[model samples]
Target chain A: MDEAVSATAGARVPRTERGRRTLRLILDAAAAEFGERGFHEAGISRITQRAGVALGTFYTYFDSKEAVFTALVRDMSMQVRDHVAPRLSGTADAIAAEGAGLEAFIGFARAHKEIYRIIDEAEFVDQASFRTHYQSTVDRIVTRLRRGAARGEVREDIGEVHGWAIVGMNVFLGLRYGVWNEDGAPEEIAGTVNAMLRDGLKP
Target chain B: MDEAVSATAGARVPRTERGRRTLRLILDAAAAEFGERGFHEAGISRITQRAGVALGTFYTYFDSKEAVFTALVRDMSMQVRDHVAPRLSGTADAIAAEGAGLEAFIGFARAHKEIYRIIDEAEFVDQASFRTHYQSTVDRIVTRLRRGAARGEVREDIGEVHGWAIVGMNVFLGLRYGVWNEDGAPEEIAGTVNAMLRDGLKP
Candidate 1:
């Protein structure tokens, strides 16, 4: 977790390492609670209980359920970014980096199936966070594509539409191949999409 | 509306043309009701009020709020299909068909912005309907791709992943360009994506 997200609004920033760990616990517990019960039915007491912390401890980190939920959305969004960023750096080129990013994302989604439910629920629960999640994600893709274009790996005209298109493709692929079922291998799925990205759909 | 969806479970099927008109009014009213107030907050009386019909008339077609919501999901899904299907047929090839389909979908989405809120809410309100909406949409895309491949327009290897990817692309494009803002022209957005589909992101 980074300082920016760790210091989420409505929540006191944890100064100590132990405090950060406790905040992490609360956030993880919140994910499970909110993911299972949704924003309406999920309770702060249950979140604290799941975190194995006193109710006071949860309050110490988050001011309310809505606060924690908002923080959780940011936390999860950051988690995805952090997870994929490292993988991209090690890939061969921009196109290969996207393949790596998609594969990593699918693996992350498989491990944290609750992500889609939580992030998706944000649309109704916290509209700003939901929009931010997608907008920021697409913005990052645009940045990466621009960098790739600079290197002559991506088309010069690549812009926001392409970013949204790629993000949409990755998101649906994650939903189908990750959360819904593991019918296809992540490598194969990523490879197929990467091929489409590398070459047109034309035979 | 077609017979299959018109006869949604938990709704009384209208036999006569007048009955069908009443049913159509109720469904349209339900779309406005659920689209505005959401499922849990929307009421049968309000839907009737919106339809300019009696409460008994509302119940004549739908048994409860859930029933109407489910029907609305199917109705909206069908509306999107019906809107896009005709545009696809007039296109020269499968790829052009996809571009036409996407263009049509974006236009439909702009006209029915409520469709996203209703369909997305189904994930929580009625999981079956939510799954069916995407599954059926993707299935249709797969069938189209298969036909395209048979005609040597689309690559033969195009399958479910590609189907989901394309649907995801169109959906996100719709959300970004159609619902969120009308900053981009639908034709331009569709044309850009169509170009990407016709040729990959490679330089």
Candidate 2:
């Protein structure tokens, strides 16, 4: 079971390893169900069926469809954070880390194409979760940029505006290059963006 | 009626000045209805009421609730483009133009806070309009960047990727600084981002 899945406040915490496995199954199933059918159309029965669990088993973890959807949004948000964190740690500088982070993100988006749908849907379904997902993501970027500034790799005044800019850039890039089509390699796309980030668009 | 409102394929174009006013009233009413209540909860009757028109008058322009929603999305898209085009044209160079454009967008977003909700909801209610809105916006940015490149103001290789990045940055900035809060002045926010775009983040 992923650490991210365990943090969902909407889900009841599992007590044992077996229970954890069951919870994992339900979450993954929820992702597929919500990703395809959306909030209004998705059902708990279909989710349990996809998870290969009984209806009672799903009730043990989540009380309602909305609860599960909320949990799933948190889980996916953490999933993205976890996936990109390690890549950032391995890079040489702030700018290079951004390049690596974007490459990892685009790859993640390609693998979890439903992520966009789920996150975007949260805006209407669970507004708080949607806002938190982006706020936290931007906060993380600010922390990273600040760290880079302390290390003398980034501008000393690096702050929230830059963080939001980078996150937005990565997101739309993921939407276009990762989910919409695969015409550009993730590395090439990241490289182009990194070059722009490292040096402005000016000639 | 605004030129943007006239281009909507879902709504029938008005044949006379009075007809155009009626259509304009319907479209504006739809924006408020869809923006406030969303697609599923919004109703055609409610739209006509808001427009101060009879139910029969709505059918004269729009066939259904979905038709008006689709038209509203396209109208808002063009609204943003039309609002920013002149700002871009008046600037000294591509970079400066982006600053002006971002400032204009943030101001527009502040005035029309519901624009975000309406456009974002289009993702779920009308996928084609949502995608077309972003694609057309990005295409315009790409064209501007190419023109800048030709004049040696922007990098020669600037294309769709850079276009998407700028649009994404402007959008998130508008959401944060425009709709979410007015803590930062539009000029200051745009200037900060413009500096980043004018020069890399390196110390």
Q: Model 2: what is its DockQ?
A: 0.58
Model 2 regions lying over 4 Å from their true place: A1-6, A200-203, B1-6, B200-203
lDDT of 2 by residue, B76-161 (tens): 88889889888888688878888899999999999998898899988888999889999988988888777877888877888788
Question: Residue A90 in candidate 2 has what lDDT?
Answer: 70
Interface RMSD of each: 2.4, 2.5
CA lDDT of every candidate = 0.87, 0.86
Question: Chain B alone, TM-score of each model?
Answer: 0.94, 0.94
CAPRI-style grade of the A/B interface in model 1:
medium
For residues B1-203, what per-residue lDDT tens digits would candidate 1 score against the true structure?
Answer: 36574546457878789998998898898889888888878999988999999998887787788888888888888889988988998788878888999999999999999999999999999999898889999999889877888887877787888888999999999999999998888999999899888765221
Q: Distance (Å) between predicted and true CA of A25, model 2?
A: 0.7
Cα-based lDDT at residue A1, candidate 1: 38
- Tens digit of per-residue lDDT, candidate 2, span A1-203: 46644466699888899998998899999999999988889999999999999999999999999999999999999899899999998788888888999999999999999999999999888999988999999998888777878888777888788888888899899988888887788999999889888774222
Q: What is candidate 2's TM-score against the reference? A: 0.95
TM-score of candidate 1 against the unseen true structure: 0.95
lDDT of 2 at B5: 46
